[model samples]
Target: MLMKANEPVGSGQTGLSDSEAASLYRLMTWLSPSFPVGAFSYSSGIEWAVEAGDIVDATSLRHWLASMLADGAGLCDGIFLAQTHRAASSGDDVLLAEVAELASAFATSRERHLETTAQGRAFIEIARAAWNSPPLDRLIAVCEVAIVYPVAVGLVSAAHATPLAPTVHAFLHAVVSNWISAGARLVPLGQTDSQRLLVELEPVVSATATRALKASLDDLGSATFRADLASMRHEAQYTRLFRS
Candidate 1:
C-alpha cells in the first residue's frame, strides 16, 4: 500500500471493523459550504444566462444544468481532479504545471476564470494558513503563483489521506450544488425544485467521470459557446446581483 509510516492500520487490512470515521468526518468538513472558500459566490455562468432569458423556469434550468454538467463543466473538472490527483500522488512537477495550464486555459469566460482560478487561489491561501500540509505548501512554491482549484483540493485530500473517489465526488457535487443554489435565487425556482435539481445532477457527475476517463487531450478547449457568451454579457449587465 506504501502509505506514510504513521498511517493507521484499518479494518480493510485486519477486518476488525474499524470504520474510517476520522477521514469521513474530514471529508464532510471540507465539503460543507461553510468552509469559507467563497464557493457560494460564483454561479459558473448560470446567473448570466438565466438573466439573459436563456433559462426561465425549473424545467429549463434543470435541463440547462444537466447539459452543463453532463457535457460541460462536470466532465472538465473531473479530468482536472484526476490529473491533479495523479500529480499529487507521484509528486510530479511537470504534471502539476500541466494541471495549472489546463485550468488557466479551460476557462471560457471571465466568470469561469473567476469561478475556478479565484477559488483555486483561495484554496491555496486558506490551506497555507490553516492546515499547512507539505505537499500543498510545496505546490504553492513550485507551481506558478496562481494556484488552480482542483490541484489545491487534490493536495489537501491526498495529504489528509482521503480516497480519490470520495474527494472527487465531494468536489463535483459541490460545484453542481453551487450552480443550483444560484439558479434558485436567480430564476426564483422553489427551494424544493432546487433540491430536486441536485438529486438529478448526481448522475451527471457519474456520467462525466465515465467520459473523463476516456477523454483525449484534444478535447480540452471545448465548451458550450452560448454559455460562454452569456457569461461575457453578465459582466456588463446594467444591474448586477452576482459577480458572474
Candidate 2:
C-alpha cells in the first residue's frame, strides 16, 4: 500500500476492530442533528433555492445537492476534513491548526462564514465538555480563528482515533441529510421522497469522499455560483425559514 510521506502509518485502515462499535457510536452521535451544531437552522442557501423555485421538488433538490456535494462547499470541506484528520491522527498540531484556519478563511460569503463558524464553535464547545482530550484542548487553545464545521469534525474524530475515510463519509452524509431535511420542509418534500433522495445520493457521497482522500488545499474550489448568490440573497430575504 503506497502512502504519502506525511500520512499516518495506519491511516485508511479500519473496520470490525475491537473499538469498531465505539467508533461507529461516536460518529453517529457527533453527526446526528441532536449534536447541537444548530445545523437545522442553516440550509447552506437551500432555503433561498427553494424560494427561488430552484428546488421545488425532490428531483430539483437532488440535482442542486449533487452539484453541491461534488463541486461546491462539499468538495472543499471534504478536503479540509480529510487533511485535518490526517494531521490530528499523526499528532501534528501545527498542520491541524493550519487546516483549521484555512477552512475558516475559505468561506466565501457572509452567511457562509456564519454558517460554518457558528457550527464549528458549537461543535467544539459541546465536544470539549463531553469528549475532552488533550489534543482537542490543545487545538482549541491554539486555534486563533474560529474553527469551521469540517475542521472541527476532523479534529474531534481524529482525536478519538476514528478512521479517516469513514469519518469524512459520515460527516458529509450528515451534511447532506441535514440539507435534505431543510429541503423537505422548504420544498415541502414528502418524508418518503426525502429518504429516496438520500438513497440516490449515496453514490455521490462515496465518490466525493474518495476524491477528497487524495485532494489537498489546492483542490479546494467551488462552482456552485448560483448557490453562493442565493446565500448572499438569503441574508436580505424578507421572511426566512433558515439562518442561511
Candidate 3:
C-alpha cells in the first residue's frame, strides 16, 4: 500500500519517518553522480583552473573550491535554490518566475550558461518523467524561460515535499563532490586524496547550506572573479575534457 506522507516507514524509534526517509532517498538519488543530469561532464571551470595552475594539488583544489562555496557560484546557487524552494513551496508563481529569470541571467560566461542550463533541462526532463507532480507541472508552466540547475533542483525538491535544508545541503555537496572529482582526475590525485577532500568540505557544505536558508534574493552575488574568468577561458581552451 502507498504510505501517506506522515506515516512511518520503519519500525525502529530511531529511524526516519516515511516522509523523511522518502525525501532522503530522493535527494540522494537526484544528487547522485549517476543521475542523468550529465553533471560529471562539466567541471564548472575546474578544468581551466587546473590547466592554469591555479589548482596543482589537493590543498590548492580545496582552497579554490572553498572560495567558490563561500564567495562564488556555490553560494550564489545556494541562495537561488533556497529562494526557488521557498517560492515553490509557498505557491508564489510570480516570485518563482522572478527568481528563475534572475538565475538564468546570472551565468558569468557562455560555457557556464550552457553548463547549468543543459544539466537543468536534463534534470527537469528526467524528473518529470520519473517523479511527476502537480507542483512540478505548475513550476514548468510558470517559468517559461530556461531553468537553471539550482532552480530545477529546488523546484523538484519542493514538489516532492522535501525539506529545504537537506535539499540545499545535498545539492551543494554534489556540486563540491563533482568539482573534487574533476580536480582528482586533472591533478592526478589518488582515491584517498579525493575522499579526504570531501571529508574536509563537510563543514563548508554545512555552513553554505545554513547561509543559503537564511539568505534572501538580495544576497545573490559572487566575488570569485578568477573562477568566473576560468569559465570564460575554458571556452577557448585548446584541450578540454569538460564542457565548462
TM-score of each: 0.86, 0.91, 0.94
Give the Cα lDDT of each candidate.
Answer: 0.74, 0.89, 0.93
lDDT for model 3, please. Answer: 0.93
Segments of candidate 1 deviating more than 4 angstroms: 1-19, 213-221
Error of 1 at 126 (Å): 2.0
Look at candidate 3 and give me any clashing residue pairs. none
Which ranges in model 3 have alpha carbons more than 4 Å from their true place? 1-12
Which one wins on TM-score?
A: 3
TM-score-based ranking:
3, 2, 1
Model 1, 46-161: lDDT tens digits are 88777778899988888887877777777777677767776777888787777767766777777777777778877767767877677666655656646557767776776666
Leading candidate by lDDT: 3
Error of 3 at 200 (Å): 0.9
- List, residue by residue over 51-96, the lDDT tens digit for candidate 3: 9999999999999999999999999999999999999999999999
